[model samples]
Target: MSTIYKSEAGASEIQRRYREALRAWPVPAEHIHVPTRQGETFVIASGPEQAPPVLLLHGSGANATMWRNDVTTWSRHFRVYAVDLIGEPGLSAPSRPPLDSDAYALWLDDVLEALAITSAPIVGISLGGWMALDYATRRPDRVTRLALMCPGGVGRTKSAWLFKAVLLRLFGRRGIRRSARSVAGLEKLQDQSVLDDLVLTFTQFKPRPAQLPRFSGDALRRLTLPMQVTVGDRDALFDSADTAQRIRQCVPHATVRLLPGVGHSIFDQTDSILAFLRA
Candidate 1:
């Protein structure tokens, strides 16, 4: 919808490019659309049908393609379902229900029921991490394990980067690229294609302005399942230190990794996440 994109043309272009990316999915995958109260939700299902299921939830403004680098390795051992979160720049509907409501958890319930999955491990990043926490805490009996990368809700969201991003946008495309790289912590990354994709995405995508609701200590203490959190020390979006501290204080049993020089968009975490999922 226009609410999610700058214009109709941008929406069409984003979807067209998304379809192009899906065609070149690293591993063999089946494109699926599950019906939910919100609308049709898109998912990329991979790995053997008999393998244990592992759900993957990417951050805001990203689709299942965010998992392209890791899916090949992860799918080797588990049935991977990379879901396109609603209201994001994915093939899913642009329906954004209130974050304070039960809409997301219910939508996930529909997805799980449709997939015939009783319980499964979940891997989430940034915004997806918040949603994963929301669902797991509400439906604890349904989640086997949790792996979060720079997840929101547990951390204090920052506003400094946003102000800088806004200023950088005034300088044109070059400035926008700088803002994207800095925000994503991709400054040292050698992957030009990844940066290119990031630039293209932000140029047309209208990111959700609402900040994720921080999880209360009471809500976090309810998670007793196997949990692992990895965040970068240099993250500009969320307070990585606060996230680490809360998880430690609330869920002592959870494994926490605070990377020295990571940002909001963490990459090359395939093996670490796979180990957590398989553990």
Candidate 2:
């Protein structure tokens, strides 16, 4: 849990690179401040506005920057809109306590309604996947298809990384460093390029940490589309085999696969995801 300051060379570099990356991305990205009952969410839209829109969601402690690399791939076939979950640590506003599934769903629906995007594929990573499924189930008419990357709330307690990150946020500034490398799930994010993406997520949204209620499975029986579920073979929080089995029980034809040695960052599998979306 190393604390990084603005005076730190690496921290400053991450900030410079983030601004440059946003400026030089392949497609046009406009930030949307969509308001909801609780607060407003910052969503980034890439590709053509008229193209079929696809929503991308990031995991906890991360932001829309998680899907930066993938936006280039998804833009060719569909308009890509990646969101910083309202209460996430990215560019979105924070919510007070009393977080709930219905609140999450309502906030998400508000974003879509404001954007006038009624139906399109939703690609969610970790918590994003959890929200996608919850939104689809609650208002089935809004989501066209569900493509979850090792979705959350599948009855896994370890799905949350906040427990381990607490010490970092509290003592990171004093050089109480943990192997930032072994922050648990992210693999090789210390590399320069990967580090840039992670840094953007960290700086863009300074999350106000709060406990998320354990995700419920009330929508399991409500799935109604060509669902695709993929997880990493070594995912610490996601049980790939069990997750696939559960998804199968709901949508029999749901295609599921395990990416070996990749852990829970399934959205990092750009080629695999692009192919899945194209199919």
Candidate 3:
């Protein structure tokens, strides 16, 4: 299988930083590696063993540590499993699976089976959100509740905006920071260290070029599990208003929120997400 990093040295450096970030996780957690056909999936488990489970999936180019700020609060109420998606710049396998197929769904099934989780609530951001939705659609009985943060595949993504993002990538660090700020609609990033790490990963890692596969209206309509969808009004990737509207129209029982003055990044909604999960 092809690797995602440009070079072995670059991959090592990124892995080193990933380890450093994991070490600095605010809450105590256990790192476990589970074998699967995709590869060895890495998971950070925390909270009580007897507590209800909450599965977390991070966006593209990020590992489980992407939930660093939110994990502490979530661990207080439920057992949290922050999974590093396979083929990303985490401790997981470097096997890149085709996004258009049911590969991700199958891979997730293996991970969940390895963990012995029959059913659980899932929270995901961006690309991770797409994965959660894909899995839920494929195996509805396995997912109890679903929360998506600025998730892709629900609405149309503008090609012009994607071109602009590609242009921003050419100018290096300042361009990256500017692009991030533009996406979040925030003057300052919530975590600069995380941003710095992302920049490094971008330079060193070879992320998949394929855009997330859009879910059809019929697919959304088929979701029977309780669902919550939140997106920033200013999201540069997808049309946020359209996203919320589609969720409401297709998934009639879904709770949808469009945050004003926000952008593609919706990490700040951790508390509301916790409330939604508990409710």
Candidate 4:
């Protein structure tokens, strides 16, 4: 088995499921695998060939499949590139460089170059949001806009979930299901299939072990592009309030939204995010 998966058979199952998801992709798409210094990076491209390019970066432990619900709507107006982040449970390479280093940014540089994108808007969630921020801060000129959801780094990442997850793991599948629901805020998830998929994927996938490296106030201040951030007030993974406050303080011009009674997962914001990207 690849180091990222628990077993070889499990890896095959994940890949098979991923391929099935791609086959059922809501809209027509072109799957492109770009070679980077890290390794091969998988990307799903959809929508008008000449339309404005918009990048979609999924959170850790996820792949391009996470955007299946949102892509059809977003692609109507933009050429969407849903990238399978390297080292995740996707078709991408399992080359997880240190999160604290500039390697990720450099890897992205290679990706954008391979895709022939000069600059474009980026939408990211969770760990992906942290990556978008990292890249934007390091190379602000390349990002036209940013729309982030429950991004890490800016907020104080909470450890409560870790303890809960560890304790829950002892109970096997039932415990894992409950833990996944808690971490993903599955209570709000409207799609049953997504829940099932999440449970199945995590059962075999081993997520990155390192904590996301936090971005400094100075780094956030470098984001002069149009930006939008949304987080759930009841987020179990990070201090959403701190995330809001930090963005307000550091990126004063950026728009921020804190949803009440929500959790780590924010869903069904297709229109709002698209509006922000289009604006």
Please write out the lDDT profile of model 3 over residues 117-176, one tens digit for every residue.
999999998889999999999999999999999888888875666566578878878987
Off by over 4 Å in 2: 1-21, 96-99, 159-179, 188-190, 196-218
Provide the overall lDDT of each model, using Cα atoms, as 2-decimal numbers. 0.92, 0.68, 0.86, 0.92
Model 3 / residue 200 / CA error / Å: 0.9
Which residue pairs come into collision in candidate 3? none
Better of 2 and 4 by lDDT: 4
Candidate 1: regions farther than 4 A off: none
Better of 1 and 2 by TM-score: 1
Q: 1 or 2, which is superior by lDDT?
A: 1
Evaluated at residue 42, the lDDT of candidate 2 is 81
Model 2 agreement with the true structure over 49-157: per-residue lDDT tens digits: 7888888988776667767777887888788888877655555665643456477777877888888998777888777887887777778888877788878766354
Q: Give the TM-score of candidate 2.
A: 0.78
Put down candidate 4 lDDT per residue, 196-247, tens digits, no spaces.
Answer: 7788877889898888988998888878999999999989899999999999
By summed lDDT, the worst window of 10 consecutive residues in model 1 runs over 1-10
List the candidates' TM-scores in order: 0.98, 0.78, 0.94, 0.98
Which is the winner by TM-score between candidate 2 and candidate 4? 4
